[model samples]
Target: MKLAAAAGGTLLVSPNFAFAGEVDNLSIAWTTDTASWDPNQRLSPDPQTILKMVFDQPIDMTSDLKLTPGLLTEWTLADDAMSMHVTLRDDVTFSDGSKLTTEDFRYTFFERVNQGEELDIAVGFGTVSDIEILSPTEAVMQFSKPSPIVAQWLSFSASYVVSKAYAEKVGPEKMKTSPMGTGPYVLTEYQRDSRIVLTRRDDYWGDLPSAKQITIEIIPDPTARLAALESGTVDIATELSIRDVKRLEQGGTLNAVTNPIARIIYVTIRADGVFADRNVRLAAHHAVDKDLLSKAFFGGDAVTINQPTIPGMPSFLPDFHFDYDVAKAQELLAASGFGPDNPVTLDFATTNGQFPGDYDIARAVVTMWEKVGIKANLTVITESQWYELNASGKLPPASLFVWENGTGDPELFAGNMFDADLPFATYRTDEVTAMIKPLLKEPDYDTRIKGYEEFNQYLIEEGAMIPLLQAIQTIGYRNGIEIKPWANGLIRPEAITIS
Candidate 1:
């Protein structure tokens, strides 16, 4: 799967500092900082990883994405499957030494559902009707219908519990900087866009971490992060491009590991503006060669997608895919009444290094569009700026976006991006909105598959989005440092050791 060439090759490897099996303090260079300290506010890998340190959800998922207990000791579902009962671990306590109770679970779930309009993870709880406390250590969560997947949704990081009393005393605004949870790490300092420092709690309920102090420095540029790793300043770096991985691994002072995640890096076109014409959008889709892009930018490590779903996912329809055809694209452009003299121009927005080789891929796509008589103007912005534009509905007609569904559920992708009420949705229409109801309400497994099939068919035929490729999570670490990488590209601080 190695595809990218060695980058500039200018970074010099320094001598190793820590001896084998001597991990005490560790520093990691992450591509982005937490958008919010409150666990339920934002949904992304960096923020989720940070929240996992300070907060613990009632349930957690294994690497294979199976549901497991975190704060809860046992769970039971009614025979009808409409209600779920879980018992909390009375021994679990927050960093402040307050015992965790069922009331904390009620407060977090209710708050998330009430603020569903602005949160991405809210889609997971669509069937949840109400949560009732049975006792101090037990509670019941009722759903509108039988939802077999609700337990897995509860394991998501967005469901991480916070102390109701602590949140009430501090208020929502203060919680953004200071959060209270029952995880193994205590956040001591958080500097916006700079660094976040956490210390291991002496009384953590689980096995103690090998490192006592953890520092996460935000370095947006991929090259700068690699340089820091080579200079012995940083022990681990995440989101490295395939090229950087090749260079670092070849240098022999560092090790690189790549894991394909449940994320799709694709392009979204706003149907209301420059892409109002269906012919132009379809033409642009056919103009770019996804296979070539996967090889050139990703070094063949990425999976080229035709529809929203990735290859290994259950809902992926291999029969329906868009192939590269220059002649077909030119014919579609001609039918649109736009030619070389009257080229259809579009503003393309993307980030520099948000993903692996993002800038290069964007430029390459623009060049491919130019060949089909479409002129695309490129705008490279920061990750935060891109999110802001999308949230405000000010994004350009065509923009690059990534949807990472760590749960590996088909509904997470279809519901979040197409559901009209959700904050992350981009394109909205009567046809797409109408298709969302059956997908969510259908309780039968076979029937749900049919709903997704029909929904994907509509999206492909209507060209709702131009599918690109699934990103591979690549981690670069200093030699002698052992770190476990999560399936969602999260580098957990508790899993690191010097050896």
Candidate 2:
């Protein structure tokens, strides 16, 4: 299917009628629900799948992970890269019938930053000095320094435009439960962690969603989601295990789909206590058998990566790899005065069912480490607990985590992962901080890409983190419905069709 423009400059999808009747409603069994209706509060991947249905970002990312116009029709950077000019679409209106303007765009970016809201997206706007409203639908962003990733940042998390007057009138606390946006869907009913219902806005300015209503049930267990799909109670089941997906596909009743997203699963090693020794870090890195982890947990579907970034990313090094050598791991452990008789013990934390095979992979890696005289005390925690620990600088020496890079930019992939100043990173060595700080603000494209390649090499040599497998989004749906997979692993109701 292709997107076409209607007479009024609205987006329209070409109709497809292959089935018997029109599909009016859709039910999905999702793994997790949004933590808050406010899009700018958290940067996690799970919330974006639901938040995008109600809000529209300044720029939209396509299924193939390419940037396209959404709320903003045009955006250009100045020659010095110190200012950005943007033009918004004039035909868009919020669900509450408020016209969208540059004032809302300015408040979404500038006013929130000034309020000191402790937002996750605030880091992306650190260099911006002021936003000059040029017209009702246009604005100019002035920067204190050259910001190369301004356009790319518009497509990242928490970049959605909010109504200036509506937000100010309702305030922050009340706005969470009653969000108004210019998207295709309107929030009709929300029951905390139980269920969420959205109705299609008939007068939306863009392509109308095929399903008139969408019902999402939060099912945390993989088996429960699978049961819902098998019993014909739900149309789509998301975040299924690889084994379950293979079994359902073989049954000939459900269609299984998988998409490799821009997320990388790795173990973050803190640079203190037992991990302060370079030899100990290197020993832990060499102990992981990525090939085995891929075959056992992912069924050979996930890619084994040596760095945090994937193959399609700009800074991915094809030849950089650390072979899984038990002998080498033991030798390194001996050099650090750690052996079977005097093993090094450390706490290793992981989350269960957060992603496909996350807990199993963490357990397998811990077993491998034990063979090399590293005794890891494994503990499973919830995602909220992990974030709480990370915020207070109390994350364990090692923890399994996934880094989401929706923009697919090297600055966000390696730049944020290795930069010690950022909250995502736990390795706080001065050497790493010095190497990554300059690359975050580099104006030139070629120089920034090259710098990350060198920085990736340094990280591998220093054994910064244990790179595991590239994440794969797996889902199962009934045979009648068609769901296109997005590179960011988001299930867009507007992109779905039924025959």
Candidate 3:
């Protein structure tokens, strides 16, 4: 039962355990609980995982990163590329027995986040001008300019369709606790931060999942999650400790899987305070020994990155590289007119256990920077406070965070984090904004890719953000539990099946 890394690092059966047909319910313990069930409200990984089960997207991105029909049977792009015609699947109906219509798509895309709703998906949608319903089953997504990645945006979990009727009937606050959608599972109970229980929707429009019930038990401690999975109390555990992964592989009783995810573990530098100077930022970037950090903190589960965009994406330049050179970092710091006498002192903010060993990673980064004459004070904050500071543009000097390009396209990454005046953006310059503008309106795919390549390289050279590594996603599962891994690092419980 030794799992091969080439085979997605998963094992189906364990020699120590026997396959049981009575395993009709799948229980998963995760480190982070979902923030909200309302699709548009939060962009965290766990909530998006549950949203995918209870709601259907207008389109779906396959494991191989191809766009496929989900609720929409077919979709076509206009010649100008400013608009797209989407044909909905008339056979699909919401969990509330409401027929899925173009109106639902329109409301979900255009109006759901309007009236001052603080939705992150609004940024994902970019500059969508309007969603005009041509018929009950067809609609047109009109953009002010050519939107090259509109389809990709619609395929995002935040763009998952909700019954406009159900939402208006229940109101926003109530909808967060109780949601109705067209996917294979329905939220039966939600005890925030404790557990979420979902029951299989027998009358779902899509193929029913083999597991009749899915329980997402929130176990914040990684050790506790590993214990639960090893004791057979839980079928799966995510965010597993590196030590646990090695033990599972050696024992050959449980399956440990690693999916190279699209998430980039990078530091977002605020364009204020001591980090306002590009030279100081570049000095800090050079101070990071990405190789050492990945090995020490990530346990060989991560790949070091040099740019804001991650590898395996559309416009990633595979050959572009950055190496750690303490001498070069010191030179850059001295060149920036800062040395031991007037050292660059900054506070680094990060969330504890938000990502795998994030707190320790922050400490490691600070130690590395101190060698280059930059003094960094570490401030561990709660997840909510970290996000609040980032949103309000009050992130101390550098904030340790992971930005996931779930659409498999780098455009979303650029638009949300690099675009000028956007919420999460820290290094928003006219030049960077100009580079990202073409991704929205560029007609040729090659040209769009070229734009992103240039944009990412420019950011890397300018040290717009400190690129760390691709956050490797690990899954621990009991024997006979077969579940496909998602590249975006979300756990799709509906796709789980027992053999």
lDDT top scorer: 2
Question: Number of the top candidate by TM-score?
Answer: 2
Per-model clash counts, in order, read 2, 1, 0
**211-317 per-residue lDDT for model 2 (tens digits):** 88889999999989999999998999999999998887798889998778999999998889899998999999999999899889878888999887888778888
The residue ranges of model 1 lying beyond 4 angstroms of the native Cα positions read: 1-22, 74-82, 111-128, 144-149
- Rank by lDDT (best first): 2, 3, 1
In candidate 1, position 307 carries an lDDT of 80
What TM-score does prediction 3 earn? 0.92
Model 1 lDDT per residue over 368-403, tens place: 999888999999887677768878989888888888
lDDT of 1 at 64: 49
**For candidate 1, which ten residues in a row score worst on lDDT?**
10-19
* Residue clash pairs of candidate 3: none
The TM-score between candidate 2 and the true structure equals: 0.95
- Per-residue alpha-carbon lDDT of model 3 for 393-461, expressed as tens digits? 777888898888777687767666787766668776777777777676786777778888888888888
In terms of lDDT, model 1 sits at 0.76
